[model samples]
Target: MSNLTDMEIFARVVSAGSMSAAGREMNLSPAVISKRIRRLEDKLGTRLLQRTTRQIAMTESGLGFYERVVAILASVEEAEAFVSRGSAQARGTLKVAAPTSFGRLHIAPHLGDFLSQNPDLSVSLDLDDGFVDIVGEGYDLAIRIAELSDSSLVARKLAPVHRILVASPAYIAKFGVPASIEDMAENHVCLAAANQDPWRLMGPEGVVTVRTGAPVKTNSSEVVRECLLAGVGIALRSTWDIGPELRDGRLRLILPQYRASKDVGLHAVYPSRRFLPAKVRVFIDYFAGLYGASPYWDTGLETWLGPVEEARAS
Candidate 1:
């Protein structure tokens, strides 16, 4: 009677290639299957099949409806499996890939707890700054922290990526706080990662671009953070990477009038949205719980300097 039941029966019939075959698969009489199909056609106000003495064939509308019904049935089954297994039942080897610096600083450190919670699960983490073929390499998950490119892979945002310019207290004392982007370029040494992407910031008026060279540049974000900590120069760093430092007064956030474009986000990328494995689902859930709306790393720092928008307004 329900459309969902009608859809499932119709899909079974198409997949089995005959009403009799569908009845056998579902343990129903052929008459019952025929009656259900007839009811479905009547509801839709269109003929769905052409029956002959030898066999039956789908009409044009039936073919289209069958395709969608098949997809719906698959989704329903996957949803059932997901809830049945849940997180506690998760078990498997989950191979993951992540950026070298972020993996080490954030992910690698927290993996012990994750593994402890899911005792049956195992993980193989690939930490590299180079591009990794997630599906080609057979990875179960990937942690990406950049502007995501359009792709077939499904992505879930785990946290927001907010980058701000920062300098060590010692560096600020030595060089004086840069009042503006233009002043920063002229008076301060600009620390940079090995990548040559220009710093793009958004202010009340519009976007501002800052380009400058450092005496030292490395491909590693950790190295960039180290250089900034050693009073090398100012560098734009993410909150996840530098939040502890900022909270502890080891690093001073500068140029409060401007905010990085916030174009990037921390994401959990996987091959498909449908039929998500319990292992991958649980791992993503762990991150969502850990980060939530306000991450642990961001604690105390907000009170110290106030939010960026408020600072800009004042």
Candidate 2:
């Protein structure tokens, strides 16, 4: 029997659940359907299905093989479409949601180049701090900076973000630098938006929760940085967001000994679909190429500012 005919028969049998049902769908006799399945099983040297009078079920290996067949069929269809279309020029609106700070600082700055590259592609960026439903809210993609939870959504790691505790030199001068996590409670004032808690620092010794009287609170990191520059209070924030400020001496590291949670990761999350759109894939690939290896966030402020400070001192 031809491979194509065998595959069609196998697929029909799997979908229809019984040889008789598959025969009815294909307008063939039940005996013919059973014979085709037997030939396929002989070629593969595997028992593809467990047949009973009541119902038909695939064996464990049979299910795995079926999954591969589905993927192969999909790829074949995609290849045909690509060949027919000549080029995969994605022409559609790409809606994206991202955190305000990351969107403004990272994505917004680079989006112009992407738009220029794909002239037909129109992008709408919704910048918000809160989580937005990519499927329900109708966003094609969302850039998130957090620990990912187990979900059906496809999350691709674009970059790594390091959260650092920082304060203004003036604030540190007024209330000495914290030597340990414990010192933060007495010496530092926490600056975070409503509903967000101050970061807890953990080291080899133990864990320490830094509590503070609310000195300044803002939803935007840009606002937080503004307040920090104005000598409001110390804040634990992503290093990528504040590298320039720290390099310029607008902000100083608070507790060098204790480190905040190092688990902050940058993800490009999108709703899972049978076929991912080319535009979404292109953007994700571009983002990964740009930021995957060494994200600006992973570059600590100390690395960028240490030389500048040395030069100033010299």
What are the lDDT figures for the candidates, one per model? 0.79, 0.74
> What number of clashing residue pairs does each candidate have, in the order they appear?
0, 0
lDDT of 1 by residue, 185-230 (tens): 7889988876735787776666777886888867777788799999
* Clashing pairs in model 1, backbone N/Cα/C closer than 3 A: none
Measure candidate 1: CA RMSD: 10.5
TM-score of 1: 0.69
Instruction: Please give the RMSD to the true structure for each candidate, in Å.
Output: 10.5, 10.0
User: Per-residue lDDT for 172 in model 2?
Assistant: 78
Residues 1-314 of candidate 2 have per-residue lDDT tens digits of: 28767877887788787889988999999889889889989999999899998678889878766655544544455556567778665546888999888888889889888888878788889999997977545577899988899986889998766666789888877877777666677756777765456566655555566665565655666777777777778787777788877877888876554556435588999876577666677788878887875775545554633332233233
Kindly state the number of residue pairs that clash in model 2. 0
Flag regions of model 1 displaced more than 4 Å.
1-88, 303-314
TM-score of each: 0.69, 0.68
